[model samples]
Target: MVQELMLTLQALGLPRPVRGTLASQLVREFHGKVSELLPSLPPESMQPLLSSPLDASQWEALESLSQSLTEQYCCRRCLLLKRLDLTTSAFHWGDRAEGQGEAMKAVLFPIRGLLTPESDVSVAHVLAARADLSRLVPATSVAARQGTSCAINKVLMGDVPDRGGRPDALEAAMPAWQSRREDGGRGKAGPQRWGRRKKKKK
Candidate 1:
């Protein structure tokens, strides 16, 4: 298949490098479009379609499918962009209530059913919907912080004055740790003292 593409490109009088590059790009696009269409195709048709070389008619079909998909995506993108413009554009103070209504209709109302506590929708379904929505409208850094447990500013909890005179657990344990070390040192010295006493006895 690649050899055939290279030959076709070579017939166009393209240089070797250009032919190679163009062939690679064309093959990638063909594979990508085929992958997109494969899921929708019947299970029985998949093996034969993949195994055989695509004819002119088959190529035309793939090309048409790709074109239609591209058009649908562009239409969706335009709709989203227009909706975003409506959302962010300034409006009169008197129009705020109207704007909020519009926002609810445009955004919240679509997903209101999913948001209901009694809804039978699975968490995976809700998550998939959220994922699709997230792709359509990219999240901002501020939006990313929503539902996060961490605070924006760090507070020094230990630095606060201890009015109750209660020592921390670690601070209270320090004396015990020090006493153990002192005890170990005295035990070592007792062995030396016993050795000196034995020499005196001798």
Candidate 2:
């Protein structure tokens, strides 16, 4: 059958000038199988130019072809976080809304692949979903603290006073208790009697 296939391939303009070695014969057979698989593809696509003991041009062509394929095959659409429902462990895409067209298309959640540990999703899954690691890397504690400090500094710089400092502008605006404290706790009680002691009841 292989001999017949080879003869057929030769009839279709494939070169077989020499009765080659077993290795060469196997290569030709493999090429023939590939040609059968992709009958409509150009000669360049089916060229095994990068077979072991290759040439410089073949190496260059292989690299260029690989890069071209990579560019063509790269995924165009990416998942962007729109609304995250932590309670339900689900998230919606930017364009999807809760009552939009189909319920399945509106939200997505991690599905357990199988009943095996190997199939469980991990941090790697999250890493893979991140478009840019530099942007996705979490804010450091020090950075968070610095931001908080800046916010506090801005607040301190405003009309609000520090803990121990008195606000002169707020003296009249003080609470009743604070005013009473300043006035020796006077007006809070009823009038005091002067030296009149009541007589003993008969």
Candidate 3:
């Protein structure tokens, strides 16, 4: 069935992106319709239909089902929009900005702490502190080495322990990994090393 779909897509002679978008939309529509239909279908019929390669007639039925589902969705959405228009017709347009601002504030009030800054520290001071700390710290330490190895092991096993005050402590622990060279010097001797490369070229 997938092979047949691929062949049909290739026969269109469309560009790769166009063909890909068309294929994805068709698949999504088909799956959406199928999901709606699945609950009503018997267990006995489902296994055979799912396992077997669909014939031309079955594919046609699926296409028709998808078309019907899309039409129904469009009709429902149109009715909903009509109802919304009728409901909002009496609403005052002049106070929209103030009303919207109040509504947004009310919605965000519960989670304001998550959005707001935790400290009074300025950006410059924080950056200077970070630079000074980097200079004071050794190139490699026992804790850093342990953190690096622990990080790798945790990543493989999918069980990393969180650290206090630092979300990216494991990642930042590997100072040796940050530099291109093991000696902790700048990258290779070339013009490319001194400047940022074009994203497209990279």
Candidate 4:
């Protein structure tokens, strides 16, 4: 089912950015629909879907749903990181006054995602649930790494656990893009001077 969905979506040849946006939209829609339905449904009806003993087909469906959710969570994190890195690169080389404003905006989304509580539970608990499901459904391992990346991003973006009010704490916690910018990649100044220069005339 997952494969079929991916294939159908990919068939449209949507660019990566579009694909990601679509995925995010779908995820948000799914959450919204479930949230709406969950409350209205009686507890008796919910139990079978939530904790009932599943035979074969229902269990498979549950596994598929878990896999889809985890994968989308990871993809969203990656998209956020990618956007942050691009903004950081631009700010690093731009005028400080303008850069500061851009930097503030760039960090907002990831910070919100990191700090906001999901379902009133800690991220560790959420991850533990994913781990339990992974053990039961080995197929989840394929997408598990992406989920791990998202979890790590959350920690890195959040406040330092033991260190408080230290100026260097954030610098130390900076994402991989910081190092790349420092090393003269996209953030580097001046135009490329290589490639075939004017040929020495005979």
* Candidate 3 lDDT over residue span 1-202, tens digit each: 5655665446543323453467567767556756776787655443321335668997778667666766676677667656755654445354775567666556545654343222223323322342224335543787676655654455455567855666655364544445445554665655545677678864
Worst 10-residue lDDT window, candidate 3: 115-124
Best by lDDT: 4
Candidate 3: list runs displaced more than 4 Å.
1-51, 93-202
- Give the residue spans of candidate 4 off by over 4 A: 1-51, 97-202
Backbone clashes in candidate 3 total: 0
Model 2, stretches more than 4 Å misplaced?
Answer: 1-52, 75-202
Per-residue lDDT tens digits for candidate 1, residues 105-150, read: 5664466434322223332333234222334433445766565537
C-alpha RMSD for every candidate: 22.7, 22.8, 34.5, 27.2
Q: Write down the lDDT of every candidate, Cα atoms only.
A: 0.53, 0.49, 0.54, 0.56
To one decimal, what is the Cα RMSD in angstroms of model 1 from the true structure?
22.7
Q: Which ten residues in a row have the lowest lDDT in candidate 2?
A: 75-84
Candidate 2 vs candidate 3: the TM-score winner is 3
lDDT tens per residue, model 2, 10-114 = 756665536655767756776786667676764445333223565789667756765665454442211112122342344334355455535544333333221
Against the hidden true structure, what lDDT does model 3 obtain?
A: 0.54
Clashing pairs in 4: none
